[model samples]
Target: MGNSLSDGLTDAVRRFQWFYTCHVRVPHELVEHSALSLTEMRVLFAVMHGGACTAADISRTLGLDTGYLSRMLTQFERSGLIERRPCSGDARSTQVSLTAAGETGLSAASAHVRDDVSTTLDAMTPGERAQLIASMGYVQRLLSPPADAPQVRLRGPRPGDFGWIVEREAQLAPGGTHTQRERETRTAMVVADYLTAPDPLRNGCWIAEQDGVSVGASLLVDGSAGSARLAALFVEPGVRRSSIARRLIKACVAFATESGYGRVVCATDLNPVSVAPFLRPFGFEELSNQGEWEKHLKEPRAF
Candidate 1:
């Protein structure tokens, strides 16, 4: 069966793009004097977002082709919007920053965009605005960096993060043989259990947010006795294999240790799911079953 969710998400994105373009027309108006395109506006935003960036940095950040970025920079220089100076540390590269006129132009563009967004948001009811904001936040989180970055961070889940946790986990992790409906139902039950766990502190829930978006998440639950087990350790597909999972495992282990657990364990029916790849680096010992692993928190493990 076709997944309506994919179709819905695709249509929603198209609608949002149309809405944003229809309403946020003033940025183009502000830059009309320089004959800048929307693509050029994005280049300005890249430089503005990053205080001082080399051409390569801007190219990578904006996903602009080297040839296109070079042409754009040359045009921006002619329009007095930007200037490039030799990099102090790396003599081989040049750093680009906004000129006074460029700053003024950028400020005008930013102001117009802000005003348009604010006006649109203000027109909605409080509940509608909150829902819209939360939905946008969710979308941004799910589509963060293509791969995990070193700056990934772990923190306690906020008010509505459990919802996101469920959504991301269901989408990122394979559902095996369960029907779509059954998979969704089971996923919801698991999340509900996590939310209403008996011991909130002992059963820690953390989210890995990068660039102000949740990219990975993990949970620790009190096991059959005094021990605890790691559950729901997942990182988004785009930001995986970049040591994000390692950081997540460390966070869970730290929480379990602080909660007075003698050991932390993770059991799985699937062979080599997280064993050799993600967890073993943290010194987890395998059990006789070959499908379970445990890490005793005898002392603080240095990262």
Candidate 2:
């Protein structure tokens, strides 16, 4: 079963790559109409966007050999498509910029490519287009290296976010004694309680986002004796090591401290070896019970 599943996945990836290379990247009409090869068009795009950049800069951005890039620049210069000038700061380096003619050529080529892409997308229904865009984004995230991961932004929960939080928490629940339905039910209850909190100032929730997609979440709610309980802490598996969980926890702790909570406590069934490192940095000490952790907060100043 495992071998069959692996083979099927490999075949699917190969098929997608073939389709993308043939149809999605630079349509044949673009090459024929613009008379610019793919590499040339990419170099021109870099130059146009880079704005008075050095040859070294373009070479780094495009990952082209310096010698090959120099040859291309020389050809462009001869054709009056680009201008090169000695760098004011560094005599050894040259600054490159597109000429007016270069911009015009790039714009025409880009329009042709845009029209071709639009023609393909126009055939899909709105729902289909949205699904395609979301699937492509998922593929990009799955394939991109860790260094290329999108920036995570922490924000207060918005309409529809609570539902997302519950759904994701249930989906990513750590395996143990609990069943999936039980986890989902518990998450729904927690979200309901947060939404119905009596004092909004005493309770808080943060949603961690990457490129506007929710990737993690946490809640700081009133606990016994002026304390806050951190609950529903979860980060998507793909984005786990990127500090999304840390950011969510930090936000919760900060909010708890600012809201004048005496301390914050968290209960979890997560492995202590894994959970301790993250919690310890925030001054969270393990309680006598194995699955409990707490961090004492300094009292906020009175007005």
Q: Which predicted model would earn the best lDDT?
A: 2
lDDT of 2 by residue, 81-106 (tens): 99999999789999999999999988
**Lowest lDDT 10-residue stretch of candidate 1:** 267-276
lDDT of each: 0.74, 0.80
Report the lDDT tens digits of candidate 1 across residue range 39-129.
8888898898897899999988878899989988999989899999999978989899999999997786677557767888888998798
Off by over 4 Å in 1: 1-43, 55-80, 90-93, 125-150, 176-199, 269-276, 285-291, 296-303
RMSD of each: 5.4, 4.1
Q: How accurate is candidate 1 locally (lDDT)?
A: 0.74
